[model samples]
Target: MFVTDNFHSLKQKILFFILLSPLLLSAQAFRSYSNEFLTIGVDAAGLGMSKSVVATTNDVNSIYWNPAGLVGIEDYQGSLMHASYFAGIANYNHASFAMPIDKESAVGVSIIRFGVDDILNTTELIDSDGNIDYNRIQLFSSVDYAFNFAYARNLIFKDVKFGVNAKIVRRIIGDFASSYGFGFDAGIQFERNSWKFGLMARDITTTFNSWAINEDEFNKIKDAIPGENQDLPETTEITKPKLQLGVAKSWRIGRMFNLLSEANANMRFTKTNDIFSSDVVSIDPAMGFQLDYDELVFLRAGVGNFQYITEFDNSKSLSMQPNFGVGFKYNGIKIDYALTNIGSVGNALYSNIFSITIDYSFFRP
Candidate 1:
């Protein structure tokens, strides 16, 4: 039988810590959002569930979702994903690899990039000779990249695992400016009976980005307008820590079906449109479920990003983002697809995501 008493006690402790998070972080909370590209997420499975897989992720994608789950990797695995946003105006890509080092330890690495390519640079449309020159126009790209290194180890306690990540961030906007940043993340996962719990702390030490602007390039735009782009931009950016808590449960039906459901609370110490917001913190909660037949064919759904919108009439309305997905897995190869709405219901911006993963241990000597 399951030990309900122990479960309750642990639950209470987790709740207490969650409640105290705001007080401990509010003093250092930042007013602006930084490194937003990292928040877009990787892998179709997680996005299909509105990124509610913190406690259940077990594949190479765990390196991005919750590193603690990397302990679930039993074989060398590789994953890749590609998606386009804003009607194909931007591209997002991710690649990752994970392997078990021993019975109790695992390691992973991941790379992500988001870019908008072939952007027309019209600043030099009119040459110094005061003549319109289409040939002077150039095409450039704005891109953001992140490299993650993760490690996980099982604890002495039966089913508990912990992990940490060191990440390097890079951003480039043509030749005008660039930035480099570093950050860390930590996560923990544990299970009791059929219940799973996970906690992920991102940017635990506050990510810092330092920028460099090329003065020669800056001079071109500095004179584009009389009073605009005159002063140098800010050179430093800071990203405050954020927390995510997750709970999951599983059930078996008949002989060929199984169901897994999860809920997550994403917390940031800032006032925003999230469902639960205060001056000290804001909480955005999400729920998702997956159903599979014989562990092969799967279906998933989720709803999240709950926000209160103020209308032009000074009235408020509730809005949320919804997502759906399907998957098939066989012989260690998995393919997943998700149809997600990236914006509010009223805006209705939709995107299609596809991801694939494979176990490559068979290729090893």
Candidate 2:
């Protein structure tokens, strides 16, 4: 009983700081490398495929995963993925390619884009029957882009590798505003025979400062409004700083069968502008598995904690446990699928994310 009480108390203290840190940091505001959305933070290739790091093969997406995964690879690889977010209301797409310039060096290019679609613009905030509100009016639709360039090399030490990513990012919110920022990612991987250990630091300097739009800047909007005093949105920019650590391993159990296990944790920090008063953090831990029934079929199942997190005790449940997926491969073609949910406290259908991604790659000498 005493232990339970102390645990609960500690949880409250952490939650209070997280909710208050945003105000504390700026006394004021922040999103991560890609956006506030973690679903699209890393490339879609890994999202619909597997979060397994230790056993993952060399691929262009490694720029966001664990770049050290490229250590033993000697190939030119690329993959394209499309995730239909929120039942096709929004589209998430990614493309990436990597080339081994030589045995000791590799370079890669990666891009992630999300299109927000079909938003209706109107004066009413809700749907109207006789005089009821419909929904909020959206003045414009926008898409976000995060471009990545990476370089990885085998370290002088045995079975160790390192890499870095330079990110180019931007976000357009309606026609009224947009923001720009840049960030970097670093990673290291260690491998000894079949088992590997990996770690990644994402969005080290990721931040977006909203641009001030004066009358002289946006002439079109100024001309239309004439003398109307239009109030702009918040003055502080929203930033998401990535702080994540993950470890994964695989055991080649038997011929035609492999059993793999993975565990990962990520905490996103939301800091206030120029205040440096600490920040908001969300910590998530996940455990999962992969099974290879044959050379042509693969299956995966994972469960993680978004609810029982230490600092997120009072938070809403964005992801429920038990996320399961499957995949198939033939020749050089591959297909994959996974299911994830984003439900508010009691709403079951709030967010149903079904993703399907394909990959076509052949070993290159």
Candidate 3:
């Protein structure tokens, strides 16, 4: 009798695995977009310009862009942002804090979360009595989280700054599986003759994630489906290194108006849909501009994600993403809003992003 019961339990588990095969394949396989949540970016101000602020970024958001910019913090700064994607089905949130340790060094920490909550679990829909039961259905969530620790210092060379970031990545799949990953990033910024140049290397050491699967939970839904392989899924994921180079300059339009312009090139070793694609490396270029009046009110615009879209008839066309934003600052508090559109031409979704930043120079400690 024990042997017979064990066989039945095994059958159920197989059926469950078959249902979630698509998810398993995407998560376990090596891909260009591994740890893609990190690439989505943070802060309304940055996103408003389509993430083209790497050369000019110098606030709490710099923890994710180019940490070297953190040295721009005078005393202490904190930032928070929230946005919804995919028609409110998924949520992205971020928070960060930065402070200067002395006159030339600074430290910062940031957190990010992207998740899809309250998903239905139907593994237990069928009871042992051979009856269909809706009561057995459960709800669960799949979430990804990242923690960043950063440090920046002024290089001995004049007008140069250097920085690095240590990152911890965590992913959870409704208690059935989880992964932990570690990675590092390095960046440098140099200013000469009113021109700011920056370089950032993400996942410089090649980030890796090791997954742990719950055996007991995995076994609960045995071969509920026939003619399906029940082998355990892959246990490892890898994210290769990427490079970003940027240049920016700022000019005073008048006594009360200032304008800043920036351009960036993102390089990936693997061939991709970017405008410039090659087997050795692919480069995506972006540009943005910001106009501020009396350092209080601001307007921002940017274009990026240049790609060649292939049509049904095998023809290709160029496509790009556009972003817009506005900002207001008063009494050390700044509020920013951005309307960002993603996807190829004729098939795009818009998401609204909001962020707030506070700076306090009163506390020296």
Name the top lDDT candidate.
3
The top-ranked prediction according to TM-score is 3
TM values, all candidates: 0.89, 0.69, 0.91
> What are the runs in model 3 whose C-alpha is more than 4 Å off?
1-23, 219-229, 342-346, 362-365
Off by over 4 Å in 2: 1-34, 38-45, 48-57, 122-139, 212-230, 234-240, 269-282, 308-319, 342-365
* 1 versus 2: better lDDT goes to: 1
lDDT of 1: 0.83
Ordering by TM-score? 3, 1, 2
Candidate 1's residue-wise lDDT over 311-330, tens digit each?
A: 99999998888889999988
Q: Estimate candidate 3's RMSD in Å.
A: 4.2
RMSD values for the candidates in order, in angstroms, are: 14.7, 11.8, 4.2
**Candidate 3 global CA lDDT score:** 0.86
CA lDDT of each candidate? 0.83, 0.55, 0.86
Task: Name the runs in model 1 displaced over 4 angstroms.
Answer: 1-31, 342-348, 361-365
